[model samples]
Target: MTNEQANCDTMVADPVVGDGCRRYVLPRQRPGDSTGDAPRVAELKCKVAELESQLRDLRRTNDTLKMHVAKALGLQLDSPIPGAGFETTRGGKAANAVAVSRRTAPGAVRGVETQVPKPTETPTGVEFRVLGPVEAAVAGRRIDLGAPKQRAVLALLVSQVGQPVSVDVLLEELWDGSPPPSAITSLHAYVANLRRALEPNRAPRKPASVLRTRGRAYLLDSRMVQVDVHRFGDRAMAGWQALDRGDPQRALREFDAGLALWRGQAYAEVADTTHVAPEVVRLEELRLWAIEGRCATLIAMGAHEIAVSELAAFTQAHPLREYGCELFSLALYRAGRQADALAMLRAHQKRMAEELGIDPSPALQHLEREILHQAPSLG
Candidate 1:
């Protein structure tokens, strides 16, 4: 065979061929060689082509699923996923997008003067506060959310705002898998009471606008209500992105706005409850991360004293957190308290050895060495 033909045959066997298409080259036929293998080679090539097609289809499906999972987990992707704007029902069908109504301007009256509206009136719609003890306000009025169990139900719905939650899942969460005989009936009553409380003006038998009913499930329309948790997440993500882009001032503002939404321990009222506990923990961690981001921004802005004071209380609250220790020590060192910085790391080392039977992390140990030698980079 010619050199070019030999090279082609070698390239065909390689798996890393570009454009995701496999090139199959049949071996060159010799004189008096049997032609019987030609059909078999062609068949093998067909099978390879079929397999490649299937692989491409699978990759496409995987990418689509990844986008969906990211969206479900509250991540913003650079490219929008198909059908993301629509909510999916329990029956695996996409529901129609909720329509947002636009207000029309009033007609002009030629002979009458128009009075400006007062700013004291609170805007309509439900406002949810889940950063602390769960609270809901509708049209500026506090809602009587009923007993603990009922509130727990609302909390679950609020956590997954705009997503349909199955009745079975709600039952499992509410009763911890040991529901009573009347659990379904009780749940219905609670939902009815919540509907009445949230929509006092809805006529009997009319469809709900805020809390919607899907097949075997319920969904809280996010557009009809405002959730502080979602707002905080958006701001926190923005802060993180700003910090990554080297805009510490904007990062600080975003982090402060997000952190200020927290009134106290997140979901403190329902934290003891089984189902909401995970969500509470997740939100609390996010809150701490925001605080850390804010402190990092302050340090970047040369406000090391503020970071030292803030991180002092933060490290005390979370002594075992290595990032907290690193930031705190760095802040002290930058604030001209080198001795305090070294002392903090020594204390951390001792505490870790005594409490957890482990040595300090590599980052902490490196910081300790840096402080000992008065590293110029510590500045």
Candidate 2:
């Protein structure tokens, strides 16, 4: 019952310190009792260094994987990685494609894709460059479209330049049938990237709108840029309608304008895709049809001399088209060359019979008959 025993007996059990107080409590050490802490600190330091080494190795592996993906996909080495929301261009407006990586910091929302902000430039004029190689330029520069798939997306959209191309249609064209889970989201990113690149400068308070989000699809506004196919189709349709209405002079003008849009194959750089091939063929056929229409219109306008030479060359190039041969015959007959016209029709007739095992249509045969005789209407 000395002073120490008296102090212990006087202490009551507090609620904070239950019956097992000594197990949870730490003993206060004396000034010279610092023996164990240094080894514990050393162990912690070793653990940290080990973890850092593992992290470095993991980062290297990640970088290597990124390089491999980029290479396999034909992506530019300098392209913004996935989840690195960057801007690109389409029809002179800004676009944002999904970045491959958004792990700006460790454990920082990794693998979460997001739409990139649109570019902040006002387009002065959207230049539609569909004549050759099918490129788009804005601010006097060609916009960077990340990789082939993304480029293909732009190409498809541009070909449908002024219309809403549905997301499903785009997927079909982009991947045939094997689209990834992130396809739609990635498409949005590509569109955004294209917009940003098209409008790089932050101006006009709102970006120039070239692409619009329609119901479950994207619409590229034609007024936002010039499209060669649109121009060609418009003029060619006008020309054909004029010809149907018997306005030869107007038809000639329209056909001339439509024909002038043909710098080369439509969207030539995109020609390798199976999806684009049919469209290219269609455009080619349209061109041939317009040529024939032009020749017919020219003949109707009494430009027989010029039409004869041009139609003859065209028929030589496109031997299988019976209408072209027919037009050539008519043009020649009108130009006081009845014998040459009959000979040309007979040659086409033989070629068709031998190649396709088919005879000339009745209209062509009747026209041939007219050329054979000294028909006064040849004038």
Candidate 3:
């Protein structure tokens, strides 16, 4: 057939024939068209189905092997053995029985089903909000974490994040240096309760145990959960290093997010109650550093007006900090309020001299001279 006839046939024909008229004709396709990978695609899909079947078999075998190993070692496995489905009875007679379901498909692997039965429920990812009351994510929902005491325990663990919290240390913090006779049992109960609350469905069959007791201490598996305070500190430390490395843009991004994590005081209600005073001090210091880092980044970015308000608040909170005072003064001076900046420096210097019996640091003095446009001695 001619090219025009072929084109007319393609446009109007319901089912076109190939050039030889022996095979059905198909539509044109590009090199990267999804249909272009038909053979490889089919092969991959078959391979995936095969691998999935193999995986299901391996999981069943592993489950059995785990049980055997647990029995041999006198250790308990974290999951239940595969078994029959649950059956409910009425009037001493089993009726409307629900058969245990398993997913089966063609080419299924031997000694393994295509899909093993899953529990009716499973543990959802745990949510931790140190920005506010420590809350948990259970079953894809948020639940009230616990009472003040429990929250304090959670906070202690969260504050340390990945580090192990010792039993003695926890007892001391929980009881204010004097623990009860059954504190150990109480701690165990608390951990169990937390696990159950965090994973209600899995609690009975297989518990979600993030708190592990080893030797004399308990470790909270921070990797499996999110903690806002830990995230803040980690980002702030990285931001500080970024600043040292002369990457102010990235540093600003990090410090901004880190400082924003502070909804209120670090550990707010539990700070004083838990012997987390040292941690409180550390976070407070980091908070200041984060704020300073932000101001420095802003100044480096040439955002004088934006840094003014933050610097003002920071200087008020930390009048003795020479760097903060200097930054505030420079921000004000750069914003064309030289007179106000000079007054601020003098007021802070006077306060420092009176309160700490020391004058402002040389850095502050040098900044003041620079602000006043005065020439300092070269030698």
Candidate 4:
């Protein structure tokens, strides 16, 4: 057979030709090809064109269905669908309600509607307390978080309320960078359990409002929950501003409210954990600063006796804190204990030199000289 005839034979049997028309027309048949084959080739080409048209129609129908599904799910076309293995809500409450209706009454014709009851919206009155041990409460009732590791997860989220925490970061924080093989799976389980605890009445597939998924990370919505640590910071900042503006009474009130939030040691249950240790230190320091501000306000208001009592306890608890020592000594001098005030400064100086291998701060030394000279500012 001629090379051109051989090529025609191969192209005629090609899969693309059999399934549908080739994207482009096949090479023209050889000049000597029979007239009978010409009619057969034309018929086959027409059939291929019909098949291609049908394929295009099917693809258009599929695209329309995808658009409808995206609209029903309240999802943007580009956003990825969450894993179905976890709790997956269609969109929000309204979308979920519609989806539930469709599933419960799939056979009902369009005109004849079925009455599917809507799922109850989970209440948002949740409160997280991490000023001491971590605790969660919903609608005034406390939730019994299962274990230490679970509570650690809660503490980490509460510490960074409204911020998305990646699973890798959570694993490191939970295990201090030495997680076991099952840690990732276990962390997922912890998150699921927390969702159940937070919203016991939510439907099985509904997205959680309080603890939510944001891409690969999880965020605890601050709007859905109140955290005591946040409240403490707000009050403390207000108090500091009040003090700066010379409103001692207002400053004392704000500081008292801020200090009252601490039930015990900050993040007491998880203070040593790598994730919570730094925050615990920060809060404890803020508490001490609030105490000092309150004492200073009291002294400014001529309430030296109260300042002396509070400063005495505070100084004993935090001996190396130079500012506390300074406040305590000044309170003593104001209350007519010049000798005792001078002696307290000497004791702090000696302790600093022995423990820290340094002399007292210049402010403390200057205070000592003022006391020795019986300076008028001692009043």
Estimated TM-score per prediction?
A: 0.63, 0.56, 0.59, 0.63
Supply candidate 1's per-residue lDDT for 160. Answer: 73
How many residue pairs clash in model 3?
0
lDDT of 2 by residue, 1-379 (tens): 6753443332221111112111112223336544576753454455456545644544454466457644442233442222211111111121421111001111111232211121224354555556556667775677676777776777777766556788888887676778889888888888777777665663654744776778898766665665566567667767766754556677778989888877777777676566567667656766786787787767766677998889878987899877688778877876888889889989988998999999875446646755675433344
Model 1 TM-score, all chains together: 0.63
Task: Evaluate residue 163 in candidate 4 and report its C-alpha lDDT on the 0 to 100 scale.
Answer: 81
Q: Stretches of candidate 2 above 4 Å error? A: 1-124, 137-150, 162-190, 201-208, 213-218, 222-225, 244-247, 272-274
Extract clashing residue pairs from model 4.
none
Clashes of each: 0, 29, 0, 0
Give each model's whole-structure lDDT: 0.66, 0.60, 0.58, 0.66
lDDT of 4 at 69: 41
TM-score of decoy 4: 0.63
lDDT of 1 by residue, 60-162 (tens): 7435754653433433444322211111111112143111101000110011111212122223478888898788988879999999888878888876777
Give candidate 1's error at residue 129 in angstroms: 1.2
User: Model 3 over residues 322-378: C-alpha lDDT tens digits?
Assistant: 667766776677577889989999999899889999877544664566567621111
**What lDDT tens digits, residue by residue, belong to model 4 across residues 252-307?**
79879988988898777778877567677766766776787677667655677898
Task: Rate residue 203 of model 1 by lDDT.
Answer: 90
At residue 60, candidate 3 shows an lDDT of: 66
